[model samples]
Target: MALRETDPAEVGGYRIEDRLGSGGMGVVYLARSASGRRLAVKVVHAQYADDDEFRTRFRREVAAARQVSGAFTAPVVDADADASRPWMATLYIPGEDLGTHVRRHGPLPPPQLRELAAGLAEAIRDIHRAGMVHRDLKPANVMLAEDGPRVIDFGISRATELAAADVLTQTGRVMGTPPFMSPEQFSSPQDVGPAADVFSLGSVVAYAATGHGPFDSPSPYETAVRVVDGDAELDGVPPELLPFVQFCLEKHPKSRPSPDELLHLLREGELPDPRPAAAPAPAADAPRAPRARRRRRLLLASALGALLLTAATALTVLAVDSEPAPSAGDLPAGWQEWHKKSKDPNVDEDPIDADGPFSRCAATGRSLVCAGDDVMATRFALADGSNTWARPIDDTPDELGSGDLGTVIAARGGRAYVYGADDRTEGDANPSRYTVQALDADTGKVIWKTVTGDGQEATEPNSEQGYSVAVPEGVVAVYGAKGQQYALLDADTGEVRWKRPLPDPDSRICLLRSAAGNAYLVCQKWTDDNVTGTSFTQLDPADGRPRWTVTVAKDQDVVGQADGRLVVLNTTGTRRTITLINAASHIVTTVRMSEPQPESATPTLLNGTLYVTFPSGSVRAVAPDSGRRLWESNSTVESPGLPIASASHLYLASPSGRLAALNVRTGAVEATLQGRDDGGTADSSAPGAPPTLVGDALYVPYGIRSVYTVDMHTLRA
Candidate 1:
């Protein structure tokens, strides 16, 4: 392309040779540096340079590009965002953009397709690790170089931490090409994250494979609707790559695999079949494959001179480095603290979710099992934080309904127990059938499953509610859907040993707590939000019979049991009280608190002390025996989970993965571990999973699909 008269003669003192391209924001010109090195200098247009918002975005783009350095990404050589024209220069490569190549040379062959997929996967993975999301990843932004594909053009890229404040994402404004944009980009632009880029990659790969996007349409509006509706057309894509491409086109962001997972698929070369058909022998006239080239070396003197020149010109330039993301050695495999994505290798954790997503994990000894809206039942080794196995979510989307999906109840007796329900529409009303499943602790295989009759549960199981109890020995007691019948099933064979109707039909169970081999139900009947009657019932573990039933005060709810006594707390009224009832003697003693406890505080009884943690990160230790306030400490954690304690200290985690430890006696801040920012916003509605303690190891789940393990002995403030 020849340079037009209107094109600038030079940019940032670099001689402009030819006009490479022009986009909505600016024009990219082929330029030559003083040392005769080729560079691509992009200069903002006059209209955009005058727009303050556009200049701010350009400055952000320059900063983001400087942070990313990888073999598959163009290296930013120099940038002056404060200049009059706001120009940036990058190392120029001799190649055509992927869209142009595919249009000129036809669909890429299988060999080249595999190479391109791997390169792009690595490129995006690196970009995400640098805390940025390339919002625009269409074929036009990828260059088909001789070595591999190189991702270019960060004009629309954004730092994930600042996504919430992005002004361009305001309503009625859309970014990225319609054919390549993700569903979330159009529906919830403010919530678009790294998964959006993965969706665009799928579209780009589909275009490279078949010379057309999956949601191709003449009208941009129609293409956007097709993407949001999950209407993809992959008729021309090769069968070998069909499933891989489809995996990336999932309607839900969490359902799509990560870039690391995509790279694994490409490396395995096993999309149903490992062996691809041999390519037809190329014609003799065809050009031979280009030999692999080594990285260009820079002389020490020249590098020093460039650094000095950068200082003189007040420009930002970074040396290209080939460092990759963290590897196994960098992870907390043994004793060191480590963090990783909560993913399984064998199972495709594409969940069919009905309820809002959040992780619930249960741990026993050295085994940890977790399930959530996005993850199925996955077991991780508590010693090294390695995923052992995972049970996939139900793949039958046609029958998916509004009920529980992969909710881990408890892990005990060498097994993990989970429950889910399927909604069946038999008439005007939708009834749900619940199923309880048990999986082997060592292997992820399902041990047994028991389904109940078609009826919705009287109350849904949630963080604040309970429906099932996992007995440590070999029995699981579950309440039927109608909440009338209680069944005791054999954990080993899934056989119902006994089914009996629950007593006291007029009362509703408010809290179900099990401790010291005894299950206690606090039943209360309310009239217009006012409690009319309240009673406590202790159920027999052997035959599902109530061993004892006693009436109690309406305001007290059973929280935990300690020293053969149930610790009850008055959680509702302005005048808070603690009551301790002897399980055998039936003698109750009540003590009034000095101050009323906050309604949002979570209480957990450990070592005969009741510890309550507020949402403001203030914790208080109360003596149930005498209502004495031991101590209260205002820690730095916000939105803290339920506090768990050892003999000396109490530990809790925030939704952001921040781990804080407090001394038990004095309630002093002991130690803290800063949370990791996984480049995604936290879901405020999702319940935060409490930290699981196995000996000295603490496993904390936070942010977006990430879990980290830290040693209690090695934690630092």
Candidate 2:
């Protein structure tokens, strides 16, 4: 494939070398990164740039690709759905597509066929675990890499739970290759699920094995009709694989085996017999000759599957391991990998709904609490993922774009502070009454509840679009009245300690944050008429008096304060400067970052080191004082959350439930905990909840669905 004159020379800093191919949505180009790593970048077609619906679908495609990470899939490296010309970059897999290969080299041999089956199964498994379904799976979409097959192209893929609610399908649009589509896809496109991919896998395997699809016909309409009403033409399929292929090609989605079940069958060497069970009995008088021959064929198939599966052993461990050995140090006394939905046992209904979905968590001692729009504040043991109790603060659904989302703010002294809202009126335009509840961490009992509002009338706390809350010295702080007011409440009693209006209530934005047990009100305004810069006001916890006020540039964002110095990030032009302002002396020290950061990059200051995580899955640890790059490493987890640090490792979680542990000193990934398949949609655009690190135990929340715990020792690099 060669690049055309119309193609761009570069995309997102990746140098485009050659064109890989083109599709209805975009063109994929072979590119190279700054570090000389090869990549495949898909640039959306220009004609569809202005199409709002098309952009939405493209965003969904990037989300799906980022959610799925495994050996049998091309992991997403970078993407920008909001760009003028949206594009995504994935690791380059140099191999011909299955369709091209079969056409040039004819049908694959038994060994390669066996490998393809298992690889596709693994790829589908990973996608489903991320709560997505690759609605379009065909020969042209699968790459035959040297190690195994890699699933590519997520243009038409979508989350399973969104199937029924998909807007595109409402117009009766059917979007997949007819021969590879499942019956349910044709009969009920909105209800298709992971089983649909299994059906496509079966068709793909049949094509690879015999150079033709089982449901092939002259017209796509005829082929689709055959797929829905006719039996598969498995006449040419290898005898050893006939049973498995037939099982996958079942007309009913429910009858088709799941990806896990297919893998299990291959592993157990007990594929169903293709021969009819009503065959004349031969055991009584014929020495069971037919049964013996069938057993031999099954054994041969199993042997082939096992031999090909050897290449995927590492991937299997990374994807489906129930438990793993300790890698770096000793784990907690009884710690093990465990997962549980945060739903209350008494509540059989669905979790609360929200426009943007994510989770928040806090941990203290041996207890962890997580809350989200999907579920209420749920308490779990740090040693295991078992929840002792679950409490919902507000059952009413949050309005879209209302900033009414709730979450666990902090956990301290055997109590968890939860920030939530109670909707007093049905669909009222006025904002809901915000409430903060202090619950006993061990028993999930409400200790105290208080209602307060910051004069600023702000949005959700910890939201990227809004400001964040801080729990300092056993006191909880919040803003209200559009960021014009501030309040502090006692952690144990949930009683308002002090409330006050800010000196400048008309500031553009005001953040209630704290550092080193001291409460601070940060406000900033940079407008055409009034550029007030930014002000940091330290407030007295006892009397609501401003102890001191520090002013900096309007663009400087406070990351944290350390050793009586306020640390802020200043992005001016191409330089990312970390400025440290001494609280007492008012001395400022500026350290310019070595590399430019993306707009989506988030900086976290932990234990004297400033760690910056990007949307591309890259993490960099820098010396706060000197701006020296300590180390940099890229993990498989995409759209990672804020990182939590231990003595030796930095742990991060992805919205799809994947967790990665990087060595803090060397920046090498030391261990990875496999994600779980919760059979629900994952919002990849939202950052995941940071993991709670307590001793050698780690508790993590998977999007808005469930919480899991793992022993740090059980993770291997």
Candidate 3:
């Protein structure tokens, strides 16, 4: 039943001023606390007064809200969960939800989207720190106030403790709005934690960007089905935000990015706003348009000049030449000394050499991992640069039509996982195929190989067609266009122990293992384009079976896990927001950044500090938890890789072959390494890899050829 304006004049010493809103669960009223602060108070429906289960859940929500209240969320002022009609109150935010804003003013501009992403990421980080998860996140719940986006509504939130309790709700009974449900939510809820919130953030961002959810279905049932079975409809999503959104909407939740990763992507300007709706085609013979022709010529010349200037600057940096190696006496303790010649023969003719030089190297236990043009792999070593053994892989050609060699390498469980795709023709229906190869970390022997589903392989490159792999809980989790698949293998023999297929092809998955020895599968759904919704499921690793499920947003990115809560980065790409979801209580809290930073920068979180690196080599560190900029520096040259951090410094590598190290605590440039000038040209046509750090060494691959190793201690000493 709908609530009437005169329903209640007072409740729990707080006089109700006016009716705010009404929903199936309860009615919200505008109220004032004893301290004179305005608040939004929600009272449960009379019919549910006898539902002990729901009352308990509501209590859990109240607890969660109190735990995670902060800059980005409406703080919980008071609550009477045990009252005849359970009631809860939160600070009243005087602003419009994103839905109302978009409805009233179409889609947000590009700058708004960037700001939204940054703000949302910080908010999510805060909630995660407090150990809560907001299971139900949507545009209607986000307030676009003057200060920033403020996330409200914690009616269906959960904490880690509540999530672990015995099932109080029926199985397969949907608990959230279908339009914003994650795939895992349909299959499992008890296990759904912070990652589930990320899926919701992605959906919310999609709705903000193009004024439509990633999944817009005819009916709630249909939406749920589509969310659990189809792809994100990303047609109207901006190209710049596409990759990041896609990563967030991966069918496998584990593969979804964390708030930090999404912040980085946003800062890097990787997510572009949707191009203005294509202008109507001109008439075939609409006069010989001389003015239009002149404008086009002028624009082309300006663009060319800018490109040339950029190229010239990059070349100038590369021409600085190599410097003599620093002596061992200048290094720190436990930092061994070593050096070696490039195993890559034909250095002069190498395609990577044409771009510039290799800047750094990394020693991972007994492996010396290096980066080269379009290639990165591991070589046998032992804490030093000395090669226990060397294994070489063919590099991709520097041509538009050439195949791309995998660039990211992660070594775990005695095997190295290489992420790459075989490039294809432009018009080819399937232009790229993502593959994961497991090689013996010690011998570089191919242990096993797995390709994405046939449907993914059949899709075109520009379409949803790639996979990401991560090792979680002793299992090789592979996320692809079709869904998440895993191969539990023997750590030593590489023999497959078990395999399981996820529920949806378009679901983004993230693997979260709780302290209770339970494994949760977080999955978010997507359409062909936008991130419409998210869902989470818990699976018993012993035998993959559905547990409980929770729904988050239409679009969101899982940022990180802390104290049992999942941090999520929510954005429409044009307007960023961060939300925290309590896996146990199903409560959500959101906060937005004051303004959007440039998209050219990527964000990173270290010891509570958020660092964003821009394409122009500028790096800014912000305190998302506190909503303040810790430091900003533009002195270092930018690179394609993510920022690498050590105990004392933050390092960034430029494609032009320079490694800049900054003091971590002070954000000061401590040293600069003018890497080897191999005279190699960069593959401007392809995506670049991020730098890798292992032990005291930094490994960087630039322009396509060669790998360089720089001693952090030596540089500092």
Candidate 4:
């Protein structure tokens, strides 16, 4: 592309000589460093230069890229993410990205394919070793340098999702080019690891060999479906190269070779083929089995970034790390850790929920109250690993009943407040009835229960719904997602103090919180025309009256409560903007993010600061008031649970069956303890249940239904 007259002559001390390319996020300019070295300088789009989220993201990309070390990857020469235009300069190797190279000519030869594969594998290994994943590894991001294939983009993290949402033309269309994506990237984008890049490399090598994507289609959607559900067509691929490509495309990330492993496999130039099975002629009376099973394509995710295989609710085992809500004091003496299964002991994990975190746990100062699979509610000792009670709450008449105890509303006083619901209808999609119950902390005895009178209106079965953290001198629970209702009950007696109903039952309300005994929530609504937005409402829990409301953009989250304000993170395209709504006047204030954030979940807000932990085990703390990042710590744990914090430490659990403690002040990993290796699936549990701090002791839960506690005093030492 030729440089336009409007192009800047210089940026960040580099002299811009020409235009390399323009992407949704920014423009790549050919520049020269002071040392007379040629460089590829990527300048952020003017529109995004002022965007806090993109800027933060760019900073993260630079940080991550600087960590990668290898010959087959572009090296970061210099970067100024904090510059006016936020530009990054890399050693500009004179070569075309793989896509242009192949399109301009034809597919590479077999030897070149081997080189490309090996080079990319080496690059990915460098990235993985840096504790990062090159999620956006596509043809355009791979530079075919003279030495080898140089992987370009390394920081293609969450921001890539936003970048992928750009429309190609006026009529409105997705810009995703899906031929090279991995299936699980589509199926479970949150759980990607080093193996995902291997899948992309396979696709790139296949395209380099065959002049087309393994799952190419006329349309991106069809291409996505093919990548997710269809077969990889490597017809023209050489026999020797087929094994490497096939192994890289495994459906399960764990099955793919690591960087070291990939090097070993390609060392001899091929993978060993499985022993030939007896081939039988098609049965005259029976249909043939499904075509030879191909590798599961790992689909790449975008904020709608390239192609996101529509959310397939099929995979149920998301890590929902279970632990007591409000833990009391230090770890008990003479404590020995115990482990159990979160999966149903009777029927087995649902095929969909392979890592079925079927169980949830709570501590009421007496015992760990749990519910999952076949068990309704069970109490295990808080002091020792002994069963206090096991109450079966699953066999209820509510057909669509949670099949376990319902959402653990909250633990307070000496009881566990539970939001219980189930579908009485035969095939209803949502819960047909809803109610609240107070369970004994030690005995698992029901202290009190109440079925909301409006239980006839069935609500969609959403395990993510019905959660409430508002406790103005009592535990509050939100019942029905769309039909928003708030119940204020006594923490000790489970007696209903008041019920606050919204304008409609279908008004989606979330983020129930209490600040200084004041109740607040964000209500969401969707129109038929696909219009979506949210209203931040502050309610008087003492009187059940709304004090004020502030409406914000769609797909936003109330990340935390700040002094005199509420921190709201709004997503517009690929950018996540932070807005602070004044508690008194409902005025809006925007906070510029200090750096880019990866896909974050289970955000914890404390004392004017917001904390978010990622599936990659990276945790960040940002001050909503100043938009300054306090710290960002990377951990070895994968798919960490929701994050919770204390005065000086932050705590979280992982599906890898471990609990971790990080220093809040320095983002330093303080301590880690292995929970249980029940062979639980990473995708089996949700990231909602965070590690809990009761008094000075920290309780962490494992996906396979194990709980471990850490003594804060011991941890600090």
Error of 1 at 577 (Å): 0.9
Model 3: residues with Cα > 4 Å off, grouped in runs: 1-363, 370-402, 419-435, 449-466, 479-491, 503-530, 536-550, 562-564, 571-576, 582-587, 685-688
TM-score of each: 0.51, 0.52, 0.45, 0.53
lDDT scores of the candidates, listed in order:
0.64, 0.65, 0.54, 0.59
- Give the per-residue lDDT of model 1 (tens digit) for 519-548: 656566544324555677787767767888
Backbone clash count, each prediction separately: 0, 18, 129, 46
Best by lDDT: 2
Q: What is candidate 4's lDDT per residue for 332-419, written digit by digit as tens?
A: 4545544543333224322212233433566666666665433445566766657656543333432122332334545555676654
lDDT of 4 at 443: 69
Q: How do the candidates rank by lDDT, highest first?
A: 2, 1, 4, 3
lDDT tens digits by residue: candidate 2, 439-515: 78788887987665432133233322223344554444445644345667776677777778755433344555666
TM-score of 4: 0.53
Whichever of 1 and 2 has more lDDT, that candidate is: 2
